[model samples]
Target: MSERKHIKVTYSTLASPDPLLHEYFDESVVEAKAGFGKTFPMYINGEERTASQTFEKRSPVDLDLVMGYFQKGTAEDVNDAVATAKAAFLAWSGRPWQERVAIMRKAADLISERLFHMGAVMSLEIGKNRLEALGDVEETADLIRYNCDAIEQNDNFSRPLLSESDKHHNRSVLKPYGVWAVISPFNFPGALAGGPAGAALVAGNCVVLKPATDTPYTAWLLTECFRDAGVPAGVFNFVTGGGRSVGQTLVDHPDVAGVTFTGSYDVGMHILRTFAQGRYPRPVIAEMGGKNPTIISKKADIDKAAMGVMRSAFGLQGQKCSACSRVYVHNDVKDEFMTKLVDLTSQINVGDPTVKDNWMGPVANMGAYEDYKEFVADLHANGDVVFGGKILEELGNGYFVAPTIVDNLPLDHRLWKQEMFLPIVTVTGYEDMDKAMKMANDVEYGLTAGFFSEDDDEVQWWLDNIEAGVLYVNRSSGATTGAWPGYQSFGGWKGSGSTGKAAGSFYYVQQYMKEQSQTIVG
Candidate 1:
């Protein structure tokens, strides 16, 4: 294999228009539309199987554009997929760690090579800009590489321990779970799903992947990368459909050994409870939602704070689980910070993601669009909508809304406390830093949070007091956003995740395996 290229990848870097990237995206966009009405089949047991029913997937950038027809898999498909994985488990799990690492590394290489095409599909299907879309795919590749690296560095978690006597030898080995169900959400079709899927496969587990209904194209392409990397048939399977039949069946299946899900709090907790009641408890790795907040101290740089807040709040139409949904500023800086935030948000270009110049694109679907409208109405009833409180119907056929900012809502307001998952932010003032900390930590979510403070004491205090799984300090790129795979080891605290262990970190792989102790007496 060739040495991996190190690129300084950041949102700012990807946001800039590169001629090569643009050309590749432009070409792929044309190619993606060729077979619009053709059906996309699910891969089960290494064979392409057509479902009993199929659903249409249209482009969120333009409702007139049809992305493709996707199979609406059912419970029987999930059962068959799981059965295939269960059959393949022993053979896959028996392979040496080095062999598994090599195959996954190859898969990562394929992801890198196909980044442009995948990004274009993401942009068209999920309403992501070129840069945000590209970053998502690139991150997927990096996640696979990181997990493979983890396996090699830890020697596949096979370690020898201190033996009590000379007559005995003691060793600890991390063995693979029988089969894992990977249920991914739409927000991050590539990275989130591919990241966890790679971790499980590298840890020697077979998997049945059920991608979200909204963005199965990117997920299926990802499954192709795994297959082309020479992953044996039945070791990996892809099934697509609604959560009720396909998703529920996969989760509740008796033979499935473990599960990794990335979705909402209600669904995540449901999986947690449902999986626990089975014959015996199984590991349910979940990274749920976040109502992340950003703090601006009086002594902080107001300009930098505003930039960070706006970027994190409006990026991907603020659909991110870690998107900054709330802000707290010192009373002294509230006026200045709000002005800066409004000015920056007002300039964000909202249009088709396929177009190179638009920074903000449409929301994912009508549900999010209607949610934005409902939230905007609620904001007007309870508080002051300082900037951008209307939907942009003029922005063409897709689900489009303006970047919204609000002020003067009481901290107790549901708008202040709930995760809106849209291009909306609510800013409130606080005279006391301690009080602000209390308000920030009051939510049921303890996902990600950021602090913008120049004072060493206050920074330390916020770090100590802030109840977040991922924390950022004064990041202009994104205050409460941007958790890279290897660099950040992103996860959540409290209700944000089932397992507190950060993904792509030192301990992430262990979640996919069970430990066994061996003793040999000669």
Candidate 2:
């Protein structure tokens, strides 16, 4: 009814004495800038540099520039970083496991002391609310401590039995992979990078990390923690740059012993293919994207179901790989449940994450916002827009899309099957539980699935029929804890991921190195 206006925003940064963390950037409400001028430092061979070559980094919140001038690594930089890590690993891996565990424990303690600062940076750089950002920091600290505990208790040696001879003995133990190249993405930057890097370091391997160009500051701060913990200068290297050259350079290097990646499926496959083509093949642990699905049954509590769906669909702006975007509700309650869902969606506060009442923030980048717009347009063309359908133009430079809910879609619609990484959600109705289960399992993705029901039989059916690595019943699918490690068994199956449930666990020790059995007779 009235013309909308731009709102100026102020960003506040976190600063503390802990080396493991840094202060959040201060922000305020103001006319959004046409571009952000922030610069990121690249850590290579124990040195920090902002390379002459740089890339632009913009925040999706209001098209306001978050950071620009990210250091782009060249082939030479990659080689230098990798060489440093390789050289350090040669000596580091030979150190006693107890010493390695001590270093990891110190790093974990340092991270704990600096949690608030690190959390602030995560919120500032990634646009997550303070609470969610704190969760990320705490979880990261727990992961580091978990790895240390894992290393400490892993010293038990395997013994071979001698059936007939009393003078025979055999044993085995865990060892580190030489040098690991860790490439992480923007979403959950700390958790993804920290999990693999911490585990590798605890197992006695040095790492070379290439943080996402959009969010490299947090990794830089984390690296400082490693340094404060007495990790040797060359033991952990952080390189900030474009993925094309830097990613390939790291994966293609012959000396790097292994690779750990978290991002999209297409990129993951490309890395895997390149590694295979190279004569030197190595282990790669990759966590790709997911198109998580949800089902609401007639026997379920529609209110609880709606709440869970809202949290799962809009949490982290649906940027997480495990965010549930697809919903299949039984026809009996579809109308009733849709009403509650739409009301819940309308109530979500779409504003700055720092605001106490805000529930959703801007998407990560313009590209992501454009993708959300395109997907919603296509969904509208084929179906009905039940609630939200347009962007909030008042938020300048910020890419803010209303929480969208669409229904009246066919089983095979584009929005129903594809992964739309945004706050938009689509609903499909099924009359029968069997049919609902079938439709839920039809997508190529097998990352995560959720079901809401009071009947034991219905829950069991969904669990048995769903083709996902993670399944949830009567609760939101996005919930996870330390016991879960946020890392699935090193790999996933189907279009969702690769490898098996065999990696990403403490058992990953077996994936990186070979077990040797030694027998001695006197």
Candidate 3:
């Protein structure tokens, strides 16, 4: 192995990665492929426990490829995991905040150390391209570190208040909220799971994580990193199984203190309502899916606008919650922007993502592939497909689809406001900028929005009126995508998220803990 350069690999930083990253990743892929079809156990109370049944995880790139087998955890398993976490909470939370931060920092370091292997596993398990896979793993590590930094800088969230008398002492402190359940989505198994888990654990709360059935291997690797970093036994547990049995069990568990979930809007809403229905209202930090939008002003640079929209709309096959699914461009430059976007979309290579030349990979599973076909058919009936709308049957047996672009879709169409979570974008021309902003903000989701404009006045106007939580202006890297840990705080508003607080921001860590006012007489 050669000495690797210290280059930060975030979504925005993927453009120029160190050459050694590719070499190391390719080597790790070969090593990972040699260990396929192995069965993995669930981590409960620091023990590797297996269930009576197991489920096979096949790679989306090739359905015949059995990546691994994971335990088919049941409601009983969720009960046991929650019990273990609850029992571990006292001793874990009693630890000094500094000590907890130290352990979490070490875990973050371990994640970075094993980045290559983990990245390779994620790419194979989730069908993400090499760069995107690497970015997810790297972001997980950074997200954990950012939380640690937040704790330290805030002095463990302990603040001294003015005293009425010299002998009277008054101060406020934030304390952990017992056991936290983390339900992560398939698209970002590592970051969505490990990031919240790290925050909860670092805040002196124990965590029980339930990963999406589609990508448990990545979550398993993440669990190993925390365990190896000495995150005490039972402090963090991993359970894999169906959402109804395992996920609902974790959510409904009375002993569970809080939850951090990332998935579809409907499911997130269900979790929020269910958690509230418990004995008392417990905290539920949920980031639901988004129907994100991008607006291109007449004053915008056409090339930059097109590039930004193209990357955000098609990256990860547009499975991201922050994907730019709807575009509202000024009628003056709509034709030019459409042409450039179509050309860029046409050039994308769809196939096995592990291959260096392939820029886009298959959808995560059969459901998404089927959904893509249905969406394309609807577009053909109601709108004009300017670029692509076909499934690439030539691309092996995997679920691959072309990056699609639709034009002239009616603003009143349901697709304009729905979260497709696929690589299909709709373009509509707008004559008025205010109306474009109105159309962009009309959706139930307010996750992310992008705008391209050269005029300073237009930029200020966008900053003032955009309803989304994460906003980008004239950025070619990604219009609505590419949010990093410290660079941009990623969260949503309205139906897109239950809590207005964004992850990776200054206020995120405190959400894992409840504040207490402490006072003593001297």
The residue-by-residue lDDT of candidate 1 on 1-522, one tens digit each, is 334233334455655555566767777777777756678899999999988789999888889988888999989999999999999999999998899999999999898888777888999889998889988988999899998998898888889989989988999999999899999999999998999899999999999999999998999899899999999999999999999889999888999999999999999999999999899989999998999989889989898899999999999999999999999999999999998999999899999987888988899998988889999999999999999889999988888899999999877799877889999999999898888888899998989999998899989988989999999988888988887877887899999988889985788989999999999987
- Cα error, candidate 3, residue 209 (Å): 0.4
Q: Indicate which candidate wins on TM-score.
A: 3
lDDT of 3 by residue, 73-149 (tens): 99999999999999999999999999999999999998888887888899989889999998999899999999999
TM-score of each: 0.97, 0.88, 0.99
TM-score of 2: 0.88
The Cα RMSD in angstroms, rounded to one decimal, for candidate 3 relative to the true structure is: 1.0
Candidate 1 lDDT trough over 10 residues, lowest sum:
1-10
lDDT of 1 at 230: 92
| Tens-digit lDDT track of model 2 for 415-441 | 777778787778888888788778878
The parts of candidate 3 lying over 4 Å away from their true place are 1-7
Which residue pairs does candidate 3 place in steric collision?
Answer: none
Candidate 1 vs. truth: CA RMSD?
2.2
By TM-score rank, best first, the candidates go 3, 1, 2
In candidate 1, position 446 carries an lDDT of 89
Q: Identify the candidate with maximal lDDT.
A: 3
